[model samples]
Target: MTTTLFSAFWTYTLITALTPGPNNILALSTVTSHGLRQSSRVLAGMSLGFLIIMLLCAGIAFSLATLDPALIHILSWAGAAYILWLALRIATSPPTDAAVQSRPVSFWASFGLQFVNVKIMLYGITALSTFVLPHTRELVWVVGISVLLAAIGSLGNLCWALAGHLFQRLFRRYGRELNIILALLLVYCAVRIFY
Candidate 1:
């Protein structure tokens, strides 16, 4: 790849990874409503999810003649539903150390989520097809880009989660209110994905 193309690829990765999508938004909300320690799991999950999705998208791009429209449709709906469920959970979640206990998002759940994470899936396909695939068919570059993007995205998620922790100071005064707002934002993101 040309130097300019490589720089553009990284630029795209940085912007999308840092953008407040399902992974970032949910992770931020988790840390805010819960705590950084508790939210770490979600951030880990997002990284894993992104990695898996990138690999899968690369595979499909390499092997398939065309990306299946039906699959994209199914993924869109499924992802939206999952995000909606997460929104509900976040909205109704208890304050830290309250009467009720809610389990943090598990690693497996987070890892599996990439299968339907349309944004990351599309990003992966677009990256591989536009930037990497045309340059060479070598698996090394594809895997390298995928792994690198995942690492960068992990940092992005970490920063967002940390921002949530930073907001914990104000949370004591308005936890539920903040949760509702974040939850609503999640719902907005979910709905926006389809429209």
Candidate 2:
């Protein structure tokens, strides 16, 4: 890739990773409700899941060139529906109080979430196709780039988790309102999938 294209790719990757997508939002919510210690498991799971997705994207990038458009549409619908369900759950969740006995989000739960997260799937695929594939067709290079992108995304998740930890007191005070807003943002994400 040319220097300009390389710069553009990194810019896009960073912006997308840092943005409030399902993974980052969930990391923030988990840390806010539970503490950083408990939430670390979810964050780790999300990172692992993201790495696997990126690896898959690396392999699938070539096949996707000839893949049917309908398959992508079907996946999008499923992802949006799952995201909407998550939004409903978040919207109805109770406040984060010591008296409340809500179960912390499990590693498996967060791991499973990545499978349905459309944003990161597209993020990986787009990065691979638009930036990496044009420059090289070698498997090693493709996988390496995907892994790097996944690391960037994982770092972004950590940033969100830390933000939640730092603002835990404030979040606890307005937990309900913040949850509602997060749910609304999730709803917007789901809606955006269609358009």
Candidate 3:
């Protein structure tokens, strides 16, 4: 049973990590503006923040069994708004020659941003509630799952960042098109949250 549960947990974690979300989007953007080597620090900060958030979510799920759906909806809406704001910032920002010089996102900023990242919170709660066995064993499993998921999610972030790096030329060549795509993605996420 433990092995089966762990397998399911791993699958869930992978799917959650690979999916498009605010963190992934930000990571991609950072990579495009900077580079993968520089954006790695941002990924580190994000992973650390995600680990902390996942641990909190695991504890809440184990103790509460369920979370308030209304709160989740509110969080989702807030996340969507934030994404839209980011998209707008990207669209309107003037191109800088200095941006090619690798600049890392500040750790505190990355940590704080992850706090309101709805997708990570939802993923944590889902993993804790679904895969963890009920009891003391559940707590142990939750910790293990959270750590493993954090690692996997970090790798997924790296992949997204690398994708941005590989396509940096394309981004530079077709800046307007990329902005439109990003704006559409933000709008889609916003609509999805309400629907």
Q: Residue by residue across 1-195, what tens digits does model 2's lDDT show?
A: 889998999899999999988888888888888878888889989999999989988888956674467877888898898888878878888867951367767898889888888899899999999998888898889989989989999999999999989999999899999899989988998998888
Best by TM-score: 2
Query: For model 3, how many clashes?
Result: 0
Runs in model 2 deviating more than 4 A are: 98-100
Instruction: Flag regions of model 1 displaced more than 4 Å.
Output: 95-101
Per residue, candidate 3 scores C-alpha lDDT tens digits across 1-195 of 478876777788888787776677777777887777777778888989988988888777877867788888788878777777866865654334445664556667667767777778878877767666353455677788778767787777877888888998887667666756766775676566667
lDDT string, candidate 1, 104-175, tens digits: 777777667666677787778887888888888888887887787778777778888888889876764676
Q: Mind sharing the TM-score for model 2?
A: 0.95
Query: lDDT of all predictions, in order shown?
Result: 0.77, 0.87, 0.74
Checking candidate 3 for backbone clashes, the offending pairs are none
167 Cα displacement, candidate 1 (Å): 1.8
Backbone clashes for every candidate come to 0, 0, 0
Query: lDDT, candidate 2, residue 31?
Result: 88
What overall lDDT, based on C-alpha atoms, would model 1 receive against the true structure?
A: 0.77
User: Pick by lDDT: which candidate is best?
Assistant: 2
What does the lDDT read for residue 183 in candidate 1?
Answer: 80
